[model samples]
Target: MRNGGCCPKLDPLPGEEESAVRTSHWRKELERRRDSVERETDGSNMKTATRKKDGEKEVRAMAPLAPQLCSRLAQKAMMRSSVTKSMASRDRVRFNVGGQLFETTSTTLANAGRDSMLGALLDDSWNPGQPEYFLDRNPACFSVLLDLLRTGALHIPANVPQKLLYREALYYGLLDHVRNAKWGPFDGNRLRLADSVPGRAPGDGTAIRAAPDGGCCVAHGSVVHVYNWMLEERRPISLDYQQVNDVGYIDADSIVITARERLGRAEGGMAVFSAATGELQHRFRVEHGQQPKSFTAGALSLAGPDDNRIFSSCKGRLNEYGIGMWDLNTGQQGDFFYELPGCSLGDADILQWLPSKNCLMVATLFPRTDNCFIGLLDFRAKTIPWSWSDAGIVVTLEDKRVLHAIAMEDGHSICVINQYEDLGFIDLRAGTGTNSAGTGVRWSSRSKLMNRKVPFEESCYPKLATHNGQLFSCMNDSISVFSGSEHVLTSTLSRSYGGSICDFSIGGDRLFALHNEDNVFDVWETSPSPII
Candidate 1:
């Protein structure tokens, strides 16, 4: 064969030429297959690139809607979470108390105050999944207290004992609620007779002092009977027949008792005792000539709530007659106001500390002496700036003897009451430069309008007290309440059972009146306002 191309080609034998042609055909076939595969691959690659570019374009086109979708999903999640919390907060709670079931809301439990046991249930630890709470308590009392939490009113069933209810109330921290619902805040004009306790001995209650915790102590001869707010006697303070002169509360837990000096032993004086235990805490001693002298303490007076000084009238054998001040915290003597010539400090029946004027009012009322003497002693200056006495004043039919006196809250005047139910006022501003004997008292006959139908066998001296800008006076078997700026007689409180009222004390939003006949004492409390 001739080679027509520019390059020369070599000829082969017949069989070899056939074989070579088959080989050439096989190689061309393989090349053609490779080229076809490469074309298919290129087509596939181009299609894949186009699909990727389309996916990217689609992603770019949807970019603005992505944030809106995410925000909508977030809002939906927040709404679900808030709904869950709201449902949890509004979920009802059940309490299985003493096998009794109680159902209440979280808001109702919250009204019990966070410090209370029921209110504590609203805390986070209280699982909302919890179906019921169990409390092993008196169910009846629990029911009453739960009602109190619901309605802010306490109603005890007839079967439930008051003491048992009180115990439950204390356990639930609802005693204040119960007390408020029962007695309410003290209003002198809206007083009601709550209870009466008979004395240990008839006509033996010498003095009745009120406690800060709505308790009281009655001095019966040498023994002092202390009663709590529930009228339950705690302990009797006895002085071993030494005769208790006066008793006052240094605080809610402590009581200072003044007893007459023993005849020869010189042991009876002023001692502070525990109101609950009746144990002696400390003894107040008077020192004269640098030696502890045996003395007798009289009326007790506290400086003020912020002050720690206690003042007591002291009398001794030598010359220890004066007002002795002692540090109530340390029981050490602070200072002594020696008895002045015209002012009888030792025999003062009433000693009141005036914080506004920074002075002490010492009054030696009648029956203790032939005349009455009321003097304001400034301890800093050691001078009687103002005083009033009925010494030289002529006694007339219209002038009644001043039995009891109390300084007004304003510190401008002193209120005095007589046995004939006459109210008098002594102006402190008018008698600035005058002597105690020359200070005149203005008497008012407004209280005399309330007349008694019949006279009693025993005469009860009237007492005067100023509280919440109102005046309280107890005469005979009744107590008169005076109100307004002029102190007009507005209301009268009288009881039929107890005889003539001997003494009355106003404290802790309650009034305690001690009667003379049966040694009975009456409790008066103000009613709460109606809930709207």
Candidate 2:
């Protein structure tokens, strides 16, 4: 212990040695407890990780089943809806019209159309849970309408008046159906004379225009007599003793009339009138030098049903002589085409608008002018794209002067007829230049080939019309029908009583021919072709 002699080393006390041993043992026990706690935590973390992995696997396995379940649910719902609709459509309905009981299916009433009165009964909110509907309407007409809805055919008993039937149809909103059933479709070959209406005035009708709805208006002097589809005379339009130059239907309810200018008036001629009430709705005015001036409108030409433009040849005391355009709805002037150098548009006897080419055909024929002038006017370019005239052409004895001209349906040529019953064709695509002077017309001897003799009476100026690929021409008392590409003579329509048709119009599945002898008019209708 005292080897170095610097300091002496002493042995530890007994109690201190024992306390150090106990402290060492307690330190080892605390380290052991800390190791045990770490092990337990690691075990708990492993369990949590395994549980999370199991949950992820379960979710991935169940994902495909969801869409299948939704698809099954949707299919069930659609099947249920379809079954319900089928049941509802087959539901029975009862109607008591004017104390007469009638029964039908919901499907039949649905055919009456939703806008019709009968169709209103099919609505679920309309008197729900009601056993029967009571309508305060005529039972006889109801029976006819019901049969029409069920069988798709209309048959009127002799006891029921036609006007009464039509009035009832209007109430039920079935007038269109009735009109279709009455007159099927227009066929010149299958036409049959349905009726002959006597004229109201003493003079021959100047014009006969067919209405959109199977009706017509006959213009005689200053009076225009309108007749409905039932051949019932409606209110006649009076022009205050002014001569009617041209008349046309603006719609089923309104008509545009062009009359000669008054003696002292400056601007009051063209007017629109209510077809039903004969009330004047509008008066068209012509302007020259930025001022409204008096002018006489002649030869009205309406641009198709969808177009809103009304074109007429206007003539005035001043230099306002040309084709005037007006708004059909507003009755205001839209544009004025001044007369060209050699073209007299103001005195054109025929003005026809060609929708396909966006041009208007102006024809100043033989009677209107010494020489016949036919021109195709392009409004957008303000130029005559194609024109033809007999001014310089030599006329032989066989060649007749063109009296009336109508553009063909194909829009490639124009068909013209003369007093001598000759049909001539003018090619629209013949020359590269606008002037068609030296280009001769292709004349057809179809009328002469048929060997038809002219009547002894004053030969009426033959009129030309084309409908549904068929060409129609009237000579004396007969209308010759031409068909096919070559326009071969197909048939002729004539009747004994009506002598020499003055004017004829075709529209709404009907043809109206006005006779010049007794101011009588004939109504021709075609039977509906059997549906295969």
- Cα lDDT, all candidates: 0.85, 0.86
lDDT of 1 by residue, 193-312 (tens): 998998885445788988877889999899999988778898899999888889988888999999999898968879999999999999989988689999888998888779999998
| lDDT accuracy of residue 377 in candidate 1 | 86
**Number of the top candidate by TM-score?**
1
Listed in order, each prediction's TM-score against the native is 0.81, 0.78
Q: Which RMSD does model 2 reach against the true structure? A: 15.1
Q: Where does candidate 2 clash, by residue pair?
A: 266-294
Show model 1 residue runs off by greater than 4 Å: 1-91, 113-115, 120-129, 394-399, 432-439, 451-456
Return the TM-score for candidate 1, rounded to 2 decimals: 0.81
Model 1 lDDT-worst window of ten: 447-456
